[model samples]
Target: MSTAHNAFPSQSATGAERGALRGALRGARAYWEMQKRCAIIAGSVNVLMLVVFHIAGLDALALFSVGSIAAYALAWLCLQRRHNRLAIGLMCAETVTHAGFGFLLAGPESGSHYYLLLFFPALFLGSSPRRAMLPAAAVLAAYVALDAWVYAFGPMALISPFDQALMRHFNSAIIIGMLSYLAIYYRKRVVSSERQLRAWAGSDPLTGLANRRHMDATIRALDADRRGGELAVLMADIDHFKSINDRFGHEGGDMVLRRVAEVIQGCVRDTDHVARWGGEEFLIILSATPLHQAAETAERIRRAVERIAFDELSCEGAPLRVTLTLGVAERAGQEALQATIRKADEYLYAGKHGGRNRVCRHADDPGRRALRQG
Candidate 1:
């Protein structure tokens, strides 16, 4: 449990709010994953630079590179442990070390000042915007002081002309490469966020099924396409749901709803769509299915729901049983979706009044009456 839980409550008031939170978390996690990737890449690059500097006979640079490697390694370890703040601190230390080395090697004259640009992306990636501000300011101030010192007094070690030119090119290359990576990573994150936002807008948070809005949109789309054979709609209501909630708390009610959703989804075909219409009620849209077949599917769902013991969810040792009444209706000619749903709803009410745990379809009404008489 964390802030995510508070933002994404188990019992959300509206589907839109729940969907928005899910989308936000998806976007946030993607950015976090990118930051972790950046840390690993930075660590590997530091190790490679350490070896290169060591071979080039640059003692001071090599020693600083060794410290940089250690700092990045520790940062990486912290990330593995899920200690993001510690990893950010280590990355800051690594940045400072890199600046110090820049001063010791060739200072401002060799374009070592360009290395400061690296801190911007690294700091932003590793920390939140509010938290990154202070560290970014401090790093910038330190780099400015170092640059002023180098300009006023000159570099400590007098490196050869060839080494100065090489250092300048190398530092420039690193900055360009890092900038390229940041641009691509940010772009990809934006795209992913947009996609998740769309999905959340259409999805129900509790059961991960299509929300009412999405279902409506889908039905409208299907209705527009008249080429389809036939469509059947089933309206299902859990029986004695309030009593279940009364006996077992709201948490238990939530669990039962989720279980019912799963059972209905498992009973339906892949082409069929299931949605949580509202509290304790679900709607199923079966493509190319007639009323009779849809009734069979509803019966299957009813049986599956009845079989659920809900042992884990029960407060007492006794097992809990839940039942549902389903009504099936098929779309006729160019009939409106809402009209068909109304027909289904009428049948569902009839079944609920007659007896719970039964499937009622237009064709089965007479047979049910005869059976009752017999």
Candidate 2:
């Protein structure tokens, strides 16, 4: 195998890794925005709670509220400074502090334990699932230890039944609100993830064109709903592709492929389907297009590719030019789509052998027709 061929897989893997990293960074930024919003809302709520507790003459509750507000303010500052790790750390610390202090102030019966439940979802929302695992485990351990300690040591202060009932109701409301926010956030994340996965599955990783599998699926769907309209397929291959790779190296070969795909897409109608068939080959499915128009489109694509300025792609500063060979075939009514593809492939090779830079049509080639008749 050539060095380029041997290197292509590794290059593709590296590209995928880069793409994944980009996606992860995007997800992290989105999560940070959500966390920031949550923090601001929670901070505002804490301020209101502080005022209420102060008016009600509940000194202990007011003190806890002040601490919560300070923690949220620091978290916000860290987030604004783009210190996401620090922000996450502070948020976790604040959650643990709330759980520990709330338990010491009011104990289990006053719903102080509900504050501990927020830690897991908060950690999960602030960071990726993989990264959040350790923090979440630690939070769980702290929650358990604090609960055990609180139960063993007893409630730090005795309060009236009315105050205890009010605290329980307030804590319950907060927990329920946070849970609802998490549910909506989780649903949105799931939907966004599914869309990204579908796009990755259907598209060519390098050129961003439709992949062969997606093309096959498109052809099958079109065949099922022909509506008696003419459907044409143009199979195009890069001429002297191996030579291009040999001269330009794999990176340059990739650049040429991407440029060729752009040229092909530019030549076709928006309604038409274009796919990177495999390697240097591309397939265009033109629905409601006659055989003649498909050939014309193929010619346009060939001319566009020929016009690509390859000087910038060359390491040696020598100008380079590339050409395309295409085969045009029209689907006969009720005929299998694979048969049409096969005929197009046959014509494509015919052009490759006849002269490597031209479009071939089955109806225009008498020799191919005569051979079939024979």
Candidate 3:
């Protein structure tokens, strides 16, 4: 079996699920980007707060802002050196400490609790969901402790009602902005990962052709559309593929498959669909084509395969040669898609048995008639 089959299973149900899982969980690299953004935004916000508090003559709050700025600056340095864990620790500690000071000095009316809420989503940006749980629990414990402290004692300092409302609004805006950034970035990562996973699922890894499952879906979709156009199927097999594998081993066989697939693709138009059906066999769908035209195409493909020189592959000092036998069948009006494909497969084997490196169409086909007479 080709490595392609092992890489993407022909089973549709399992493949879809596996693809989704791989896509969803593959955002570890994006985490660092999120971390950097968070650090810059946090550091900037605290710098602004430092100026604002100093102007308002709140010396203690201004001092806390300096500490927040230093923490975030260190976090940025840690990130530069790729010390991600230390950076995350510094940022989390700074955020919790800042929120604690805000509530102690200016009270819960200042909406400092909103700052603490950032931890839930921020922690999830680190690595896997399971690993994020410990930090998430720690944040939860801190939140509960902060709430208990507020219940036991009130604010130690007082500020104007207008000042309290402004701080509340400012903190609310910051949390909202940060959360929105995380959401958008997370979505982009998931979407890109899913697209890549889907491509892998539908493609043959070795030849980069549509795999069997994807081809089957394409056929079914055409059947459902019921557009009044005739489509033709060509089932082609590499001539003496097993012998080639036996002579040159699986690696050489894989190379031949990829080369033949490229030749077949070159012979067909972009509108046509081609897939590595399985093993050494390929299936092609020629849209709006008649049986005779498809047969001509198959013959062209056969000639192209014959022309491919495996200069690097040799057995007993003779360079390797390759050829293909193809079967052509046109879909009848209202005929089942599978029935047409089966007919193509039958013709393909007929071509193989009658003589190799031939294109077999309907019995009345002139080339097929000549083959029988010879």
> Pick by lDDT: which candidate is best?
3
For candidate 2, report its TM-score: 0.84
Model 3 RMSD to the real structure? 4.1
What digit string (tens of lDDT, one per residue) describes model 2 on residues 1-374?
02124254565577578668867886777778788877887788788778766654568878888988988999999999998889867776776776678677777767877867877777776658999899778777877887788879877877777877877887788889878887887688779877886777778888889977788898889878868488888888988788887876777888888899988888888999999877888888898898988888888888899888887765466667899888889988788878898888888877776666888886456444544555
Which candidate, 1 or 3, would have the higher TM-score against the true structure? 3
Q: Which residue pairs clash within candidate 2? A: none
Query: If scored against the real structure, what TM-score would every candidate get?
Result: 0.81, 0.84, 0.82
Per-residue accuracy of model 3 over 1-374 as CA lDDT, tens digit each: 12233223443455566666765556655787778878988989988788776765667988999889888889988988999889988998888888888877777888877888898877665657999898789887887887778778877677888878877888898889889988998898879876897798888777889988799999899899878498999999888787787877777887888899999999999999999998888999999898888888999999999999898898668779998888899999899888999988877767766777888887664545555666
Cα lDDT tens digits for candidate 1, 92-187: 667676767666566665665676787787667656999989978987888888877887888888877777776667767777887898889889
Kindly indicate the candidate among 1 and 3 with the higher lDDT.
3
- Model 1 lDDT vs. the true structure? 0.77
Candidate 1: clashing pairs of residues: none
